[model samples]
Target: MPYVNIKVTDESVNAEQKRQLIEGATHLLVTVLNKDPATTHVVIDLVPTDNWGVSGKSVTRLRQQQVKEAIQAQAERRAQEQ
Candidate 1:
C-alpha cells in the first residue's frame, strides 16, 4: 500500500480542486511507481494560513508583509517618476 500526503493552504481550494488533487496524486503513483490505484491512499490536509508558519511568522502575516512591500515599492516608483 502506498500513502501520499498533500498539504495546501485552506484559503483557496474548492471541492472540485480537491477531487482533482486526489485523483492526480493517485494517478501519479499508478503511472510512476506502477502502484495499484485500489491500494493507493492520498490524503489532503488543509492548514489555515494563521496556523501555517514560515520564518517564524504565520503565512497570513507573510502575505500581509508582502502586500505592504509591494505597495511601498509602487509608491517609490511613482515618486521616482514624478
Candidate 2:
C-alpha cells in the first residue's frame, strides 16, 4: 500500500474538501504513478497557518495571498535552478 499526506491551511479545507482531495489525489496516483487506487492511502490535513509563513509576515494574516506568492516563488526558484 502507498500513502500520501497533504498539508494545507485550515481555512482552505473542510471535511467535504478532504473527501474530494483523497479521491482526486488517488486518481492522479492511479493515472500518473500507475498505482492502484484501491490500495493507496491518502491523508489530508489542515495545518495551522502559522506553520507556513511568507514575505516577512505570518500566513495567518494573508493565507491565500501568501500561498500564491509561495507557489510562484517556488516555481521561480526551480526555474532558476534548472
TM-score, structure 2 vs. true? 0.64
Residue 55 of candidate 1: its Cα lDDT?
A: 96
* TM-scores for the candidates: 0.88, 0.64
Clash statistics: count for each candidate: 0, 0
RMSD of each: 1.3, 9.9
Best by lDDT: 1
Task: State model 1's lDDT.
Answer: 0.95
Candidate 1 to truth, TM: 0.88
Model 1: residues >4 Å from true position, as ranges? none
lDDT of 2: 0.83
Evaluated at residue 42, the lDDT of candidate 2 is 90
Candidate 2 residue lDDT tens string, 1-82: 6799998776757678788989999998988889987899998777787877667766786866768899999999999999
